[model samples]
Target chain A: MGRTLAEKVWDAHVVRQGEGEPDLLYIDLHLLHEVTSPQAFDGLRLSGRPVRRTDLTLATEDHNVPTTPGPITDPISLTQVHTLRRNCEEFGIRLYPMGDAEQGIVHVVGPQLGLTQPGMTVVCGDSHTSTHGAFGALAFGIGTSEVEHVLATQTLPLKPFRTMAITVDGELADGVSSKDIVLAVIAKIGTGGGQGYVLEFRGSAIRALSMEGRMTVCNMSIEAGARAGMIAPDETTFAYLEGRDHAPRGEDWDAAVASWRELHTDEDAEFDAEVVIDASELTPFVTWGTNPGQGAPLSHSVPDPATMDDTERQSAERALEYMGLVAGTPLRRIAIDTVFVGSCTNGRIEDLRAAAAVVKGRRVADGVRMLVVPGSARVRLQAEAEGLDTVFTEAGAEWRLPGCSMCLAMNPDKLAPGERSASTSNRNFEGRQGKGGRTHLVSPLVAAATAVRGTLSSPSDLEPLEPLVPAADLAHQEA
Target chain B: MDAFTTHTGTGVPLRRSNVDTDQIIPAEYLKRVTKSGFEDGLFAAWRKDETFILNDPTYAAGSILVAGPDFGTGSSREHAVWALMNYGFRVVVSSRFADIFRGNSGKAGLLTAQCSQDDVELLWKLLENEPGTSVTVDLVSRTITAGDVVAAFDVDEYTRWRLLEGLDDISLTLRHEPDITAYEQLRPAWKPVTG
Candidate 1:
């Protein structure tokens, strides 16, 4: 029987498998954060089990940590951070506390530190652990109990999943980036299309993408109901891994590459399901309904309920009612109340630059509340160095600090009831931003354009502008 | 943690991917810490329609959830499992299940079954066309039985045993007091484990 890439990975990781029983697979890395770990640590304490391998565990404060560099202002936030620090210290686990230059979102820090190298089975109490699968690894999120399971036993029992191949073939059009491609993939597949499947993104289009782009694509696989999305580690993967702090160095680098090169699906590989998308046909997409799958091309019109299936018809009507949109109206003309330009999905420096280019000179629409948040402190610093923050602020967008801000309403960043936003985040489920708050999924460029137009607009809708003058030159001109 | 519960109801098929906990039960519901009465908020966002699947009279009393693969992904909010169980769902059958969701469901005593994608699709379509059809999920056998298909699933032995017995972590731990006490005493005071 031929096996797909996912089967190959699962087969290699399986420690023991029994009929009608889950496989007990060894976990190589366990990442923890404040929000989910407290309970897991508690479970271990109650069980009187010590952390099996402190070396394999790494802790970071991300969810509750203040995005600002200053000390936390909220008492609860301060207490949570303090608790995590104390817990890590007592457990002999390594922690990158807030303000550490290396500290960031656990997902981003893992890859940047080269701790997310290929072939490792990584588990975090965070869903975005799927982000690490871009390196050709088996990564998944765990619950508090399973977190304790991994912490105490360094393994988990998992039911194997079927494999699905999402092949985005042909060349992407200019300005259509990996972000747009992923959004398009989500739109076509709907939210649950990849459920119960390990999706292997293959074909020429996937091979041509850069490592960061590949990471961006894989990062949102969970959003599309896939266990994890992966691309074969290739020359691009090797180039990205060549000079990282944790990556193999010198002679070992060559040896590591030799192994990684063979990680691709064999020619005889078989998949349970396959979705072939023509990359050239995709356009910048935005969600009209409340979910990421409710997206359509920016040029298309909002769907009318009468045309939908009986099950979906009423909900479509309600979405249109809540979003204050009219059926059959061009999606481009649908007005937006807010525009959010950050999240794990699109908060990288490159994402910031792409948005900044569109919003450089044109101010945001008068009534639109725009926000630009970086994914991490590192991304923030890079964006500031590039003066992208200034461009965002100068265009009437609020420049906020890092953390999973508006991406979720977890922290102070939340949308009021009945508010609508054009967001660069992954999920657009109803009130995902806030209670009764509607979300329109778009790329960073689309987010910026929508901020300017107060409507769902794509970068192509805007005319190209002359490059911005450097900050120094602009300052000199002002002076 | 109650046990030996039997679930019976019409099943609704939610054929969407990446239907996360946030979608299952929004964060607004989490403002209230009391975990008991969250059934109303289960899929609240999707309940905008009077005829919504969950709200529809035909599937109103259904306790089994036939969902798509990767059934619950993103976030480890126990509220999702709580919401589903509170909303009267005892089992969630998908082709693939997210790790955190599966654990959270098991912890909540809600059985999560992993069947083949084909089996799941067949069941979903069956329920979609026939709303009142009953799907039986037997935790002991780790099998999901609909009209024509009988699909065996995978579950950890301990979780399966606990669910069948209706015991929680705290209760389970209390069952072996001597071993726990001995293990704690062997460790020095300097090494404190917190659960």
Candidate 2:
């Protein structure tokens, strides 16, 4: 049988494909965070061993970091952050701790530093390690035990997995973004669609998206039930790698690109299974029900339980019960209590600008609370330097420091019980924001419009953004 | 008991994508500490609707799950895998599985198979007409086979051993009790106390 891209990659990295034993595979990068690493580091200390490969390992603090820059006033959070710093110091592992300009969400910092390159195997203790797959690497999250295993051994023994391919074809509509595309896919396939497969996003629509867009799409692959989602390295990939901090500089640049060019699927490559979605038919999507898969086009009505089959009717009914929404109601009319415009999935600078463009001259709804968090400290500084912070504050949105705030309720940021929010994060599961908190998954533009009207809305609902600079001068504008 | 086993490592084919932990096992089901009894909540939202794939007669339940990209995105709920396994899915095949969900699945004895898009498409196409189509998942061979197609797959080693031995995580940890206890007892008195 012809080897698929996954097989080729797996085979190339295999030190030993053992008999009835797991393959001892080499990992190219290992990311660490505060919450999960302290214990692993403790284990290493107890064992009297060094972190096997410090060069391959990197650490950062994000989960417990405060949204405001200062001494973390919260005692518990301060301790966690302090513990991580001490641990890293004792172990000699490089750490980007809280308050450090480089410190931010591990997923966000990885790409900005350009450590996330194509065709590598990346592992982190956090589940969102799937975020790194945007670079076409075989990145995934490891548990504390696995973290220890990787720290001590440097290599992991892994069993091979079945392969899968998801092809998004055609050109997306003008207003549709990567966020909408992934939502549409989850809606089509339902949740749990890709249970034991690794998804390779392919075709015209995927190819046309920018690296940020591809990252957004791949970042949510975990939401779709796949092991990891990836896009092959291409010119866009090479372009994003250039000038990145850890990217090959000067002499090594050409060689790196040449190798990445070979990372594509062979002509006769075969996948174990496949899915094809027509991007042209897709529209800006939003979740009406609780899970990410319980979504419909923004123009569609809330699903009526009476009209649904037995399998979905209860969820529809329960969603209406929890969300305080009525069956047959227009999704456009669904009111929101809060608007959150950040998470590892959508907290990048581009996402903020997209939301800011819609909220620029508008005021948030009378009672709605709007929060915008940058994914990293770097992103936060850039946004502030550009006065996007003022734009957000002027629109009545709270401008906060970078962290994985509200993405999961690990930190102080959380949804009050029973409050409903239009969020840019990937998941909208019951109580995901907090106990009994209702969430609606939306794009940054949709999130911004929702903040303005206090209900779900699309970018088209707002007037076109005024040009910040002349189109002709854009080429000369420093990014 | 005849040492009977007709099962392949093959998993159910679920075509849905973006499956969060709440859908896999709602929070209401997580009130308990035990790992069992979660199958009832696997796709609880969908189960609420009788027409969901889990309830659909044609694809009521199977081992291999074939889905779209981003299979286990969102949250670190281990219940997601427990629910899938409790619901009788031994293997889950997706183009992409969330990193957290994959680790959780391995710990719970559920196989998360990562395949290429092209091969995954072939599997789905091949199985579309025959929902009961049997695909062999050989952990030893690191291969999945259905009809004439054979696709090799990957899983972390520690997880593979635990699953093949039918060892639950607690038991696996208990297997090293001597080592763990010995280390604890050997902690130097000069070491500062900490949790």
Candidate 3:
């Protein structure tokens, strides 16, 4: 039998596989941030073990750093960042500090630097580490204990993961995007559907998405209960890595591509489970409840709990109460207090461009606040160079520096109690943004359009702006 | 990691499904560098309500958590495990558990026992009907017993062995250092390196 993409990568990275014992897989790249690495480093220190592979391990200050330019004001946040810097220095690992140009979310920094390549194994302490799996890598998140194990041994003894094929076919409609497609998939499969499996997103619709879009889709794999998600490498993947900072150069680049080309599932390969989605059938989807799976199409009304089974009905009831929503209400009529347009999920330049296009001639709603945080300093610079920042700021939105701002709300950017938001980031779990903060997961286009309307909306909901005529054109018309 | 062969304690029935890591330990408590001292942060948001199960004096000393399906559903933060352990929970019984959370619990010595949905419902009824009902989770026998209502659970052989023996994963992997070095040497030179 032929091997699947996940099986190929997993087999290639196995250092030791014994009968009745879990395989010990070697890690190629290890990404670290402040929130989860301190304990791992401490464990290494107590064990008197130095890092096994400094060249393969990278660290950054993201989760606890302030996105706004200035010193970190929170004492606890400051300590965590400072501890990471000290640990990296002591352990001889490369670290991108808060003010450094390379500083950003670890998941974003990995791909932008060309460190996360196809056919590699990437591990991080944050759940969004699955973001790197867009490059046909077998990447997943590990706990602090496993983080220490990887740092000391560069290998993890992991049981084999069941393979799942999530095939999305057909072209998306005008305003639908990868975010909506993934949201629709999660809604179809309950939150626990993908547990213990590594999902390989396949078919025409997935192939048509941009690298940024693919990353956005893979970043939320964890929200669907899958520890990791992958997409086979293709021309799009190679093109994105061509001249990156750490990308293979000279003759090596051709050799790298040749290997990556072989990183797809063979024709006769079989998956443990399969799910098929028609992209054409999807619309702008948004989460109406506390979990990602509890979502519906933007054009639909809030679902009544009585329509569901007993367990689902009870869960929906709790979600409705927490979300402060009434059944039978149109989703478009739901108002929002904030609009967040950044995270590892959708904080790339393309995401910013998509939002900038929507907000070009429109103004933010009277009382709604919108924040446009870049995923990395490099992404921030790229957006500024293209005048995307001006487009956002000119329209009354806050264009801030790079870091995970409100996605997990570890920093100062947070929502107050009873405040609601249309967020481009993943995860709508209860209190994910902040205490009592309600989030509706959305795409950048939807986030921007929602900011302009102060309600849950899609780009199609926005009316075309009235074109402004130049003075000369007006005078000519008058003549 | 301590060896966890068996544990007996009162059970706290958390009726909510999809109880995510953020609800287990909110993001604010994650700022601490140390792993210990997260007891106060465990269910910090839910504990604000006076009627929460943990607030009841009968279940205040409970060391086992009988929660709805899909427990520990989001985030890879091990702080959730640390917080639960700090708050005196040694075992979590659920019909279903998120993969990463179950793995983190195994490494941290927190037993995540998976039983059938019917068994979970029965356990919940028993615990809720009489708060502070004694529940016992035996890893060796792979069973959960509560007031003459005994239910068999499912746990993989390898993880169960590691937990019963209290083995360290790092030390075990280091035993195969020669194999790792050989594999590294054969790796393609085109693979990117951070430095």
Candidate 2 local lDDT, A240-358, one digit each (tens): 88987888776677777776787877878889888899999988899988777789999998888898775467656777787878877889988888999998889998898899888
> Which candidate, 1 or 2, has the higher lDDT?
1
Candidate 3 local lDDT, A100-146, one digit each (tens): 99999899999999999999999999888999999999999989998
Ranking by DockQ: 3, 1, 2
Q: What are the TM-scores, per candidate, against the unseen true structure?
A: 0.81, 0.74, 0.99
Fraction of native Cα contacts kept in each candidate?
0.25, 0.16, 0.86
Q: Write the per-residue lDDT of candidate 1 for residues A1-479, one digit (tens) a residue.
A: 66666666677666555566567666767888876677667666766878877877888767765454577776656666777788788778998888777677788777767777776678887777887888888787766667877777666767787888899899988667888888888777866677667788888888898777787888888777777888878778777777877777766777767766778788887888889999888778778886666778888999888997753575567667767788889988778889988776787777889899899889999899998888777888888998888888899999877777787765677889888899988877667788778888888889998898887887777767777789999899899
List candidate 3 segments past 4 Å from native: A470-479
C-alpha lDDT score of every prediction, in listed order: 0.76, 0.75, 0.93
Better of 1 and 3 by lDDT: 3
What DockQ would you assign to candidate 3?
0.87
Residue A24, model 3, lDDT: 93
DockQ of each: 0.20, 0.10, 0.87
Give the Å shift of residue A61 in candidate 2.
Answer: 1.1
| DockQ top scorer | 3
Error of 3 at B108 (Å): 0.9
